[model samples]
Target: MRFTTRVLLLQLLTVVAVVATSTAVFIGLSMAQLRDEAETSALMIARTVAAEPEVRELVAEEAQDEENPPAEELAQGQLQQYAVAASQSTGALFVVITDQNGMRLAHPDEDLLNLLVSTSFSEAMEGREVVAWERGTLGESARAKVPVFAPGSDTPVGEVSVGFERAGVFDDLPRKLLFIGAAALLALVIGLIASLILRKRWEKLTLGLQPEELVVLVQNQAAVLDGVGDGVIALDTDGVIRLSNGAANRIFGILDSENLTLADLDLADDVVADLEGGTARDGVVANGRVIFLEARSVDRGGQALGSVIVVRDRTDLMALSERLDSVRAMTSALRVQRHEFANRIHVAAGLVEAGRMQEATEFLHTMRSRGPVDYPLVGVELITEPFLQAFLGAKSLEASERGVSLQIREETLVLGNVAEVEDVATVLGNLVDNAVTAAVASDELRLVEVTLLDDADQLVIVVADSGPGITPGADPFAHQPKKLAENDQDSGQLKDHIHGHGIGLTLSQDMAQRRGGEVWLVEPGGEKSRRGAVFGARLPDVMEPDDSVNYREVQEEDK
Candidate 1:
């Protein structure tokens, strides 16, 4: 049977056993109670009969006779008439009057009128009344015996005995038992109904999964939650953290999550509110990791089971993605330069073949005058690092396609190779993208400018735009501009509408903070401001110190 059915059956059997035992006990006690009542009634009736004047006088005369009275005379005796009348009036089975020798003076049966009594009447003859359940000529009965007294003396004359048949005394037993049985049956039915209701409730709660199935499910869930790389946290409807996997515990620095709430964890108010509001977001920085987060509510059978927050780390993957994009950009730039260089070489060779030596030489001089063909952007040589050169070249191309001019400011300077390339790229990518976006929104001289500098292992990046600047006292990190999101060509999905410059700003700030740095708005411009907003980021330990020994320094000293 199913688990619920088993429980129901056990409960039903328990109710049956209890009801049956209780009913039987009531019946047994009732029989004794009824028998006691019958005996009391018989004793009272016998006492009244023995106390009568006629009965006392007749029994005294019969006891005084030298010879027993004639059987026929006693048989027709008025004493017998009195006994019959008493028996009829009292509703007793039989009533008998006996002499001192225990000879019957009066009896219900005429044949037994002058005969010796079947039961001992010593106690009655001694003037003592007795009540008992006894078997005599009339079969088993609850009987009472009493002694008759002389007219004015304490001397006992004869005895009176009255009995109620056992069957008649217990005549109400069946009815009482029937009532008890009805109650037991009602209780059984109630128990059955209660058990059935409980079974349904159990089935609904567990979705009819048996006990063994539930155990296996629980075990599997535990294994999966702990085994998976992504972080999982389960909260109740009240937002209390009921369960958390290993990754979540590590991320939040929680040793034990029992009875904790979202407030108890180290999460920002906005993040908490977003989670509570059942928001889904990706590429969010939390606790030094770029993670994808989504809060999903679970319900079953129209009952709310609360929500689960899933956190997947994308920090390493994003860094690799950026690096790949940079490589692709460099490869494209190289391929373009190769095709352009091949065309120029072909032209020069044709000029040389036609004996136009002066023209070919002038063409070579013109080609050499154009600084590196691999990077066509102006002041590209100012940024010496290959990664930065390629990354900026790609951004310049994107800006050029968007009808905006991207410039590497002439003042840009770096003393050493770039370090922490991925971290630097991530922050720069956001700031440059926003700057380009701002420039595109401007009608006057749409241009985005970038400045890169290094000061003792710190890489400082400043991006300026000619678009309308930020509003005064505004928090760019908290601003929500869906227009900027709608213009986003990345992801190409409607969900991008929820992501704004604020998300990028926040993510960038989080990355900077990890390196003991920060990204901040350096200049806030008004709507009509000629120069657009300027954003700066100071990333510590992103470049090598100039003081470090290198081949150039050693060669300079040798010279």
Candidate 2:
């Protein structure tokens, strides 16, 4: 049920319980008061009738009947008349005078004069006032008995008994209780109906939102994000992951929610620390390969609530950037080739105008021999323009200038697409440049080896150099500047301070990741005296069977 409905029902039930208890207590107290008042009124009437002078005189006349009362029978008749008058004066239902033997003498009803009095009258005649229920010709009644004594004597002559019908006192009580109960029940029904109506109205106003709405909203948002190709991960202030898009899950190979955490995504330790420390930070990763984690404080109305971390996958963007760099390099090389070709045509035109046929033929032959041709590597015909080849050749020469021997190992068995030829050249160029710089200070054999091989389902390009391998203890991709001095033979503490803080491997690694691949430093062997860094790149194989044959023939023809 909706929240509003549940709240309304709970409130209605509480009101009902309270009203019921209160009504019950009121009815009980009212009945008790009425009962006490009825009892008191009955006792007062019994006492007043017993104290009547006629009652006293009747008792006296009866006592003296044995001595001087045959002539006084007329006086006794007058006393009996007075006793009847006293019974009428008290508003009791009935009054009877009973002698010591429990026999009625004077009664409100004349026909009841000879009737047997109740046992309660006998108890009263023995000097005790008695009150009890008794069955009479008129049904049951509450009877009170009081003893009458002779004038100025303590001896009981008879008992004056008074009765009041109990039905009258109890009659209105049930009706009043019924009225109160009806009111309570009516209030309860009205309250419940009001609660239900309000609940329905609330549900309508809220657009029928329930607990399931929250779940559905979240799931829908996640579904929309999952369609995106870029990885996205979000985390709350506690360093606990809140959401991860499909791309992110696949990139990290996180198939289960249980293994996801802030640390697993290569988020900066300080950023994680700040989240743990309740601070907010936002920045991009240097390489732009892994997710870039940025944290910012979440707030409401100027109050600091928590922090939110947004992760963006820059892998594809980085690849696009590398492709752009390759295009630029190719463009530059093509511009140079155009200029050189224009100069050669001008020189040939001058030779033909001077009528130097032999010399012009020699010049033509030299130009043809010097024309750019593609190189073959790893059985793959290098389909790139001559300008790119020249760029790589110049980079190789630069490495040699730095005392680093550039070696190229060609695999004769593999062929792959040249779609990324410019990009491959750029990547190799950068690696050779960095290797030359790193190997310049090494006392060991400074050699940079570029090897191409075909692995199952992919083409692997390995670049290994004889230089100090990446600092063994830390992450090879750590964001530190390149060490300026390989040997600590510099001036002072300042030299040591500036060493080992570079971004070469970090940059190269970022490039490798952009091509749907990775770069790793191969472990060195125990027997090998050379200690250097080895970087490898793996690209998807795009060579067809016919292309493989042509590529192999091209390499053979080159040989």
Best by TM-score: 1
Off by over 4 Å in 1: 1-23, 47-80, 97-106, 110-131, 145-160, 175-227, 230-316, 326-418, 445-464, 469-503, 513-525, 528-531, 534-544, 548-559
Pick the lDDT winner: 1
lDDT of 2 at 38: 62
List, residue by residue over 94-161, the lDDT tens digit for candidate 1: 99899889898888777776788999999987889999999999899999999899999998888999
Relative to the true structure, candidate 1 reaches a TM of 0.61
lDDT values of the candidates? 0.79, 0.59
lDDT (Cα, 0-100) at 185 in candidate 1: 94
| Model 2 steric clash pairs | 480-501, 480-502, 481-501, 481-502, 482-501, 482-502, 483-500
Model 2 misplacement above 4 A: 1-18, 21-261, 264-266, 274-289, 336-391, 397-405, 410-417, 422-430, 440-446, 454-458, 477-519, 524-528, 543-559
